[model samples]
Target: MGSVEVPSRHKALVYDSPGKISTKIEEIDTPKPGVGEVLVNLTHTGVCHSDMGVMCNSWAWLPAPTAQGQVGGHEGVGVVASLGPGTENSNVKVGDRVGIKWIASACGNCEPCLVGADANCTSAKISGYYTPGTFQQFALAPAHYVTPIPDSLASDMAAPMLCGGVTVYSALRKSGAKPGDWVVIPGAGGGLGHLALQIGARGMGFRMIGIDMGEKEQLVKDCGAEKFLNLANYSRDDEGTKKLVEDVKAITGGPGVAAVVVCTASNVAYAQGLSFLKFRGTLVCVGVPEGPSVPIATANPAAMLAQELRIVGSAVGNRQDAKETLDMAARGVVKTHFEVQPMDKLTEVFERMDKGKLQGRVVLDLSG
Candidate 1:
């Protein structure tokens, strides 16, 4: 597949029409790697919540990215097949096991990117959104932005790190806590939350408290969380909520967690996440709640004043974070639990995802 003209066409799933949320398998021309680009033979691709948002166009502020016949996916793991001109500086070579991420490419000269915050680069291209993503047999990526996957890591385990893991790792960094700080991850049994628990607690040395259903106790605990708060068991009344808050503080030596990172795309989670924090605590929003722009429920001026709390939003991490994350994976510090599905079953996968039945993460078997 590298610099070989075996076929003029390849299989891909394209969103032929936006708003329809429909996908179809089609034979599309295999793309040639342009300048500073690389064509990869994709093996695995992680399905992200942001992909769901893209299907539905949840973020209205940004222009709708999917036009007719646009392909969708990011978080891809593959071997480099071809490199475009001027990509020598990217340090990528043919046959390298690499992963393509959400931030497809950034203009390094931009003010924000010059400061190492490439995610906010004004002229940034995003995989699965602005550009054709990785839900195909092969995809093209800018050499500079494609992440190098550790040789020891399986493609499945490395796929989700491109998005789910990167977002949480970046949020953990913004939380401003050190090796001994307490961090809470809401929806802890879900794909992003589970990985976050492992990376934040075991790998990064921040103690973790997982918030999810009672049935998820063992899963969360196994992921290195110190405690599990069953979201279903928590009270709905103000007094009961207060008691639940006290329990969190009591469990953490009476000062609550230092930071709460909401991994679920639920406004309720964000609201309750704030309640679990101690004074001067931080709340990092990694999830994009659906529908109209709803203000974070716990953002009360008085409560914020009393607690000296801070709330911040994290998009995704830069190249440095991706490198460190993959290095940790190489060291067996972070592990991803995933189910691999054939690209043909993508529609059914989305249906189950809409019903909240799929657990962990789903990685597409592009070659299949």
Candidate 2:
């Protein structure tokens, strides 16, 4: 590929004080790639709930709250504008369309890396959190770690797949449900949930039961969900949880679902997730709740002993997962529903997200 000119400075959205709703569009020095790194001129990025969590200091497991002036965004798709010294050996050249994900870089020497679980690496660098993120037009990513975007997938569609799509794909793989088995996905109309529904039904051939608000009924069904349950119809008391479990039982003919993937951050979803699973069933936890939410109801030994339920927590997917997810999108088995908005409207998008009004993902046009 031919060399491209790069500017010394670029526009970026930065958090003035993490945990507070303060952000600014500032012009910052454009970062140059180092050895083993490539400079990506990001054209589009997906705004994720995790980005909000980082800015709001919501997650407890983070090493620390995101520092001030941190550039926060992980779901980015762009072309390589320049290659750094020594990156020639990496086989990633300038002009290649690539993607940056939540796991920015991981130490290859770590145990998790050796086991192909780089997302859990002990010394992993997180994009938009510990390291610089893709919110800006220009960002640096390790050549070995950046995902190669498939030519068939558009940049906006590919952005959310880098994180939300890969995440649910990993969770569905971990769910242990075979083709024709019933898999229940709570919060099935949101960004991650909608992708999970399509992947489960179309990609894996599993029967999908999507649970979400009433407004998302059409979307969930259109994505191939065999059954849709609206949580808005149920109360939040013990009776509501009982009704949800009963609804699952009814849909699955009393044996209950083979797997339950809770993709919502609401603790109420977690509290009732295991109840929807059959005996020896698996409940995969993907969404994380913040603050004073109660823990999962099936955490006790009695519940485990009686049901033999397996609870698994999944982080962002690895490189292999990213490749497979993009391939699925390329094949038309899974597609994201998103609105392309200019970068300046990100704060307003966040406000809409906070109100639980966003139907699907929101992709920011970085070039604007």
Candidate 3:
């Protein structure tokens, strides 16, 4: 990449108002790369559900620093088009097939970062949340924190791997289940859930049971899920929840699943997930409930103690996880099922996504 005079203006999608769903395409000044930064010409960016939550102001538990109205879309894949002064000191150079992930930058000296946990860094910048994200045609990324996407992977497919893929891939890896172990993935049809299903079952050799709606049976199975549970077909009544757990136990040979990862924000899913886990099994939490923190309605402390169950919470993954996600995608072991939507239709895309109508990921083509 060579230095070219940056134009004074560029197009950006702005979430103008809080409610009523408004996104305006306006001409904004092209931001200059700051020290230790590189400007990337974003080609493809994934429209994460969390971005929808931010635009609608529905995301709770996030510190005010992570709130939206800055810019949305964390998973961005593109070529480095500009580098700031002092950035050359780092190994990353211009024209790299790099990616901007959920974590834009982190202080490497932090205790968590020293232990390979960048996501927990005391000083962390999250793209599309904490910092200006990759929704525009050009966005600046920190050179030290940028992910080097392999040359073989397509930009459109590589975008989601930055956030959606890395988040779930890291969680699935933390499930403590080895080969042939049954792991249930609730909400297995959505972006993160679908990716988790594929990576856990196909890539990690775990026996996966996907729980979604009746309509997702084929798609979930197509993504390598060994079994499917339709939440729509079951009621919340005792018989319904009991039967669902029984079905999982039957499928997993009576001892039930080794672990359950609830990828949906529904408290019901998290509550029911524990029931399907065998004694000493783990129940992982990955979704943020709509409002605020509250104990799950169906959770029983006595039952948990009796079973010796483990409950864990996970957020976005780190740089190494991002690299492994891209590697899996590059090798074609993790196939991304997504569609490219032009920037203008982005509002409608968010609406449909909020309604839970989309079967696959919706990637935004910023160039359009």
Best-to-worst ranking by TM-score? 2, 3, 1
Q: Sorted by lDDT, highest first, which candidate order results?
A: 2, 1, 3
Across residues 33-113, which tens digit of lDDT does each residue of candidate 3 receive? 889989888888998887777776676666663343567778898888788889877878777878898788898999989
Q: List the residue pairs that clash in candidate 1.
A: none
Over 4 Å off in model 1, which ranges?
1-6, 88-90, 235-240
Q: Candidate 1, residues 1-368: lDDT per residue as tens digits?
A: 24433257888888766664567899889989999899988889998877877876766766765676778888999888888899877789888888998888999999989999998899998888768888887899988888988888889889999888888888998998789998888889888998999999878899998888777788889989998888677777676677778878888998889999999888777767788888899999898887777777778899999999999889889999998888887787878877889988888787777766666789998876
Which ranges of candidate 2 are over 4 A from the true structure? none
lDDT of 2 by residue, 306-337 (tens): 98989998988889999999999988999999
- Among all windows of ten consecutive residues in candidate 1, which has the lowest summed lDDT? 1-10
Best by lDDT: 2
Ranked by lDDT, the better of candidates 1 and 2 is 2
TM-score, every prediction: 0.94, 0.98, 0.95
At residue 61, candidate 1 shows an lDDT of 66
What local lDDT does model 2 show for residue 276?
91
Q: What is the lDDT of residue 304 in candidate 2?
A: 81
lDDT of 1 at 180: 92
